[model samples]
Target: MKRRTLLRATGGAVLGGSVGLAGCLDQFSDSESGDTDSHDFPADYETETFDGQTVPFAPLEDVAEWWENDEARFVDARTQVQYDEAHIEGAVFSPSPDGLESADPVAEWDTDTRIVTYCVCPIAQAGQRAATLLDNGYTDVYGLADGFNPWRENGYPVESNDGQASLSTYEIEGETDPADAGEYALAVHPETGQREASRIDADGGYELSLHFVDVPDSSLLELRTPSYELEGTIEEFSSATVQV
Candidate 1:
């Protein structure tokens, strides 16, 4: 499915308060702080308390180190659209606005899981998400100090739906052909019981191109038609470039 269509179908779900892009970018403006060239940590950046616990800010440099060592789980706190466009490799999507009100993707993670939440809005949105995670018993939650833009500017690794790691095509074949299978859904399950659906073209020959990030290696991909269902492992499909 195209990234845009998927985002639209999801109602542009944002994890935090629905701040406009201009407002988010304003965090970097010279008028806001009189220093435009420096990515220095803001002195006024204060600690926020949630459930009587303070959420600490994780420096971009430290987070980058953790990312390289694969020691911390990165959570994107922006809207799904922003996440789809670009995010740190392996970061999970957990929008703040919805995260506080409902069970998010990370809800089932171990309480000791190391997590860092980030957004272009920098503080308000990301901080709220970190606080929420902390309140939920995630002990090592931290907000990315200074947010995504600075990290991107520093040439750190980023992944996007448009990138090579995210683009893959597969052919679906089964007793019930998708062209005639009305209103079917195609989903990828990265973990057991967790399914993220992809957009399907009913008119096409059941050929689906998906972002690889949505279907990590070893994940399960399932196609559900009205009368039949077909499932395959991502490795199996990648092996042959087609599945039956």
Candidate 2:
């Protein structure tokens, strides 16, 4: 969706750059920052809670097919780095469960269609994504279990959103080291501008499991990047899988 498609969308280049460049740039936010929406979720994991709450996950295939023809909403639940690597087609980059009501917040929705959400893999984060939609009165809310991995695993279409906020990825880095696996988890969504992730997995593992959730989950939500080595467990859950 390029602004150039609109006749009045662009004027001529101004002294600085162009008349269309200054006031119209922010007119492009399309996530769910402050509205109501809904969709369907995959079926897999169960709902659990410790710090906040971790919901079960849904199958990726079932979810993709569900919205393949339907005009359902889509969201990415991973950090910016992970999302930049790859994401489902036509999905916005709002890590928040609700998409709207977020720091960066999605700014648009059809409302009539259902809204679906996902994260690196979709289990607890999907629940978090649903919470936002439900709270905003969106009845048709859901998560895409097995997130991007499943989509790519089956040779489904995926894209890279370098900087489209609405369809951009997040960056889940930590200022400090993370606890053992299964003990606690933290994540960040760069697309939505929600610096702190609340909804997480609390019962997937135990302290013996490195004070984190499952090994995969821990790795996904622990660090923001590999080269920098941000502070966190960086578990590699099926939901939030990273290529590198």
Candidate 3:
């Protein structure tokens, strides 16, 4: 049997200028922001009609029950790093955007398998992922109504790499030196060969606070810009950092 690999974001196109520094940092928040409140689902949340099919939202309790019974598959619709830092136990990593096309882990699941997609966003990414799965012939797909935050808040089971309960933050400070550096990606590499990247703000000075699962001190970090790419291990980064 061929082992499946999670899809990775590649090229400058993956960064796409849509996410800003602040928005990226917000993913590590312990609680959901105000924007999430409006989209929170009640116990009596209504199902929506999509593509002539009635799609339902899976309440947190329902998801918890299914998880406890191992009756449903949980898909994380955030970035791989986010998934690694902390995720519901047994949930699969399937980041949004390129994930549906590149990192589709459920491509071989039975059509009747109960699948639940969840994200920290305002019901946008998770809902889209669930809809896409439904469009692709999945019979029983549902989006987690309030996503992982609420589940975590309710003292549910979550697993983290490196034994940390939450993601570890690292402040990456460097100088691109070149004034014309437009945009760049800072990638964190764990020993397991998974790469998590975020767009770095290039204006003024170059500084970004990155989050990661338990990255061993021996893991590698890379900085990629339009003109150049530099790679080094975390040990070197701690002392010298990435200097372009």
Candidate 4:
């Protein structure tokens, strides 16, 4: 199946020099923010909340300029199959959870290099990866605010394979022991380490949307948290009354 094509059609906020727990760049407007005639890269872009963190956001326009001038490296934070289907022209696939570990290309880049992370679900996975990078000392990182769809839709540069299956969202929802509240629930693809994570809420509930290309109901996944790990097939996850 091709991607579901459910795109978010909303404008996003701009970027700042530093990231905080939560805040937004004032929504850009010529009338409100005075003259809007600056081309400064990060300032020109917007901000958005993704994956429970405030990350810098770059819209397509700023990203296009960065692409042409070689100002930033792009990272695809989706699954390998999603990357193989279609991605920005030169994005490297380094799906979250293990994005920059071991042999990932981004690991070799200088800590100060400008990096941008993106995923089709707007910015959740991308923001998670970008947040990881920033926490580990990357100087400049941003999540693609509108994600890959806008770039592809507007006919920007991309690399793609023919006849590949598009992505679909696989959801896993459950409640854990109340003691586990404030921890995380992660769904990990056993093979690729592609993952989705959500914080266990105060009531011990969590839900995750794992995006993949051509996932079978019998495919293995690891549902994990700090205290326990449960392994099961996608079909099993759908029915399991997991309480740990």
In order, the Cα lDDT scores of the candidates are 0.52, 0.40, 0.56, 0.63
Cα lDDT of model 3 by residue, 85-201, tens digit: 778898887664325455478876898889888765244446546656676677778877756778887999998753543455566666553432334344546354433333234
* lDDT (Cα, tens digit) per residue for candidate 1, span 123-236: 445755776676666777777876777788799999886444342334333333344322223434425322222122344233333333344545666544333344666555
List clashing residue pairs in candidate 3. none
TM-score of each: 0.47, 0.47, 0.49, 0.61
Indicate the residue-level lDDT of 86 in model 2: 65
Which runs of model 4 end up more than 4 angstroms from their true locations? Answer: 1-54, 59-65, 68-70, 97-103, 107-112, 120-125, 146-157, 161-163, 239-244
Where does candidate 2 stray beyond 4 Å?
1-57, 97-107, 162-183, 187-244
Rank by lDDT (best first): 4, 3, 1, 2
Question: Candidate 3 local accuracy as lDDT?
Answer: 0.56
Candidate 1 to truth, TM: 0.47
**Inter-residue clash pairs, candidate 4:** 13-46, 13-47, 14-45, 14-46, 14-47
lDDT of 2 by residue, 1-244 (tens): 1111111212221111000000111111111233221233334333332123223334556677766776566777544544665677777776544343456444456444576677543244554665655655566656565445556768877887554333223333122122222222333322332222222122222111111111232232322211222223333222233222
- Listing every candidate in turn, what is its Cα RMSD in Å to the true structure after a full C-alpha superposition? 14.6, 16.8, 10.5, 10.7
Total clashes in model 3, counting residue pairs 3 or more apart in sequence or in different chains: 0
RMSD of 4: 10.7
| Higher-ranked by TM-score: 1 or 4 | 4
